[model samples]
Target: MSGSTAGPEALEPLVRAVLAALADGAARRGGPVPAGPPDALAEHVAGEYAAARGEGALSRLTSLLAYGSADPADPLCAAHLHCPPLAVAVAADLAVSALNPSQDSWDQAPAATTLETLLLGEMAELVGYDERAAGVLTSGGTESNLMGLMLARDRVVGRASGRQVELAGVPRRGPRLRVFTSAAAHFSVQRAAALLGLGEDAVVPVAVDRDLRMDPDALAEALDRCADDGGLPVAVVATAGTTDTGVIDPLRACAELAAEHGAWLHVDAAYGGGALLSDRLAPLLDGLALADSVSLDWHKLGWQPVAAGVFLVRRAETYASLARRAVYLNPPDDEEAGYPSLLGLSLRTTRRADAFSIAVTLRTLGREGLGRLVDACHDLARAGAEAVRSHPRLELCSEPELTAFLFRYLPARGPYDPVRTDRINAALRRGLLREGRAVVGRTELPGTGPGRVRLKLTLLNPHATPADVERLLHAVAEAGRAEEAAEEAAGRHTGETGEETP
Candidate 1:
């Protein structure tokens, strides 16, 4: 074949080979993932990879971080926040990559930009925002939070007299722009403050209630103190769903306090924003539209692939603070034509059309279908919590608030030893992952004496039933018992207790 035609035809065979391999693997495994890892196949692939990398030229490129090695779709895979993408979303992602559309401007993206805008409008409506609401697509919750804080900072410091701060080079000086959030809130909020020239100390850590929700009274008191001291309280960051416990802060109360204090209210609803789809938990997000800015992650609960997040603002003009003009790119003539460019609204220059997958998923699963998925996961979490509480070996740390539960395995007939308990629980978790039996999560919570290390379960897989979670709990308990028995046997033979080894 000619060189021109051969290059294009060469990829055809490789694509066919990959599809054939995938079909055969799926058939042999009977599903996406088997009960355990394919040790032999993994070893063979590693050997081939090593040979292909060879000496100096490509050795550094072989990082051993190969794809398809971890079974994220397995019922027992519950360690991290990662999840397998839906088939529809995955297929749409492939097309997105093939198209390689840059959604930073209307001319560049066209249909993709419109799709993203429509989706953001839909999401804003779900949060009860009015026609004045607008948003921009982001990488994930972290970027969304960062963008939201940037807007808040701009609103507080920029445009005091209908003039642009950047064009005038206005020197911002005052109380240093402090923000407040609960202790249980995600770390990204503090990080955003740091990046924005507000030191970490500028992020005041507010107290939480017994259920881990932020206390509105405490927040109001904090604001009052700041006001008395002449400190600028710029924004109040509230967690709609905490990363650890999935507890949502009292949004309505927080909004009211923020308004009274003359501060911007930003809600980090990355995890629980999908609950807006659920009729039962939709009320938990009441007054969310009252927030000046909101952050959401479509990858977490929206069930789209990775890098689907959004940051919405109640007022569309808030983005003008970050606006810029470039002669070669977005010229003055183009601005007058009503062309929309995302460059003024984002921290990125070249951005992928991540919202394509989200648009496809939402179109495939309408509002009702998405809501049902969210409700189903919540119900499964409740069932799993009940099973854990009923079991003699496990103790529930708190009730199920969202699709997450915190608990620890308790040994029968003994006073809880903090060091030994931590070691035992850690070993059980490691064993679960190594043996592929389950991927039970671990966390540290305040205990009676010292803080105790505990386990957590964040159920995001809609296909995961209550029985699957029960099996996982039982397996963890059995592993814990075995570790305890081993510790007892070692203690009996030796004069030392298990504390020394740990």
Candidate 2:
């Protein structure tokens, strides 16, 4: 029997049980995360999927999984891109999943086709693109960046040789194709180059300033180097809200340079796109409008669910490279008959309705509501930095920029040993994860010591207040202090004794 054949009665028990588990989990998540050993959790989960004495087995499974999840939904979670999604967006996602619309062909998803276009248009406008702009819903920043680079390459190689690289493969142009991005830029740009057949060597890392922003002078120098090496500029990928530090590149300056070099400008605002909602923070993206293309991920800072990525281009023709005509999807007769289709302008033919959730979220929160959320995160981050500075164990590496702070801790009384410090910080993170008290992030400062072990605090929780952040810092400091103390005690014990049986 097909799983879908199960009646509502059969599902009712499972539904109620799941809801109950979810309710309990949510309530528990408000306090502390259950940071248990992964191996133990793995054993329980394995048994759940395999064993079958099962009357309320699903309830047992739900409870087990709920416990197993690190529960990043907790406001204490400042680790990575994970966060609790907006309620309105989750509701919209439920409808989307239930309806299950695929917007490739008009007949299959007429409303969704039109709706997604309108949504994309709204997003393009937000990026300061006019009505003529074109965009498509992508999986995330990686896919969006990939799409942008693909188009950028096609426009460069295609215009010169009058041959479609998408159809014929990377044309052997005389000048080697090159891409440029800030040293602080996301690694996705290099990935984009690799995917576009440009190879990783095509990516030129432009130097950044003290604040971790892409230096315009460095970009100019790199472009000149590319020219000197007999290479044509393909794209300059600017970043807004870099993953490690949340630093944004100089957008307007980068755009000017890209135009001067006749290269495509693609802005990756996956984490900082939420700032566009607020007039105050929006200026951070001052030259955003001038870009040839932009990438936005609503799932990151916009509080949407996973995979709310949008790839917007300045003109519809920018997407010509990705277009394809199929008899069943977009035929010649159908085109003439005014039947709309979205089989083109996307890497996937079976794309989900990612726009609906974003639309619902925007409608519910409006621009001001979303802006406040962004501002709150930014303000909280700055405040959190101050707190980190005042903390006994913690130290601020730099001021918070775009809701992210990178810092480290004082593990013990001894002088700073790079290797020992690295070990303490790593152990601190492990201790936190093992205890599941607080979820903070860790990063290594490039070219700093053996490894400049730094903690990353991504303030994405708008609801978290100053006190909440203080608590988070306190927890972090306590963990580090505890680990360092234990290590010191262990060293003392070793010195007192014969230093281990070995």
- The RMSD of every model to the true structure, in order and in angstroms, is 4.7, 3.4
Backbone steric clashes in candidate 1, count: 0
What is candidate 2's lDDT per residue for 115-203, written digit by digit as tens?
Answer: 89999989988989999899999999999999989999999877766788888888765788889988777888998898788999999
Cα deviation at 173, candidate 1, in Å, is 4.9
Off by over 4 Å in 1: 1-48, 53-70, 159-173, 446-449, 492-502
- The Cα error of candidate 1 at residue 399, in Å, is 1.7
TM-score of 2: 0.93
The CA lDDT of each predicted structure is 0.76, 0.82
| Per-model TM-score versus the true fold | 0.87, 0.93
Question: What lDDT tens digits, residue by residue, belong to model 1 across residues 1-502?
Answer: 2124464475455445555555554444442233344575577556756666434213222222222334456556665556667889987886677667787666777788778778888888988898888888888788888888777777775633344444553245655567999988889998988887776788998888887789888999999999999887878999998877789999999999988977889999999898898888888888798999999888887788888888899988887777776665577687689776666767787788888898888889987888888888789889989999899999888676878878888766367666666778887877665554676778776335433777888878888888988888898999898878887877732212434542
Backbone clashes in each candidate structure, one number apiece? 0, 0
In candidate 1 the C-alpha lDDT for residue 260 amounts to 90
Candidate number achieving the greatest TM-score relative to the actual structure: 2
Q: Which candidate is the best by lDDT?
A: 2
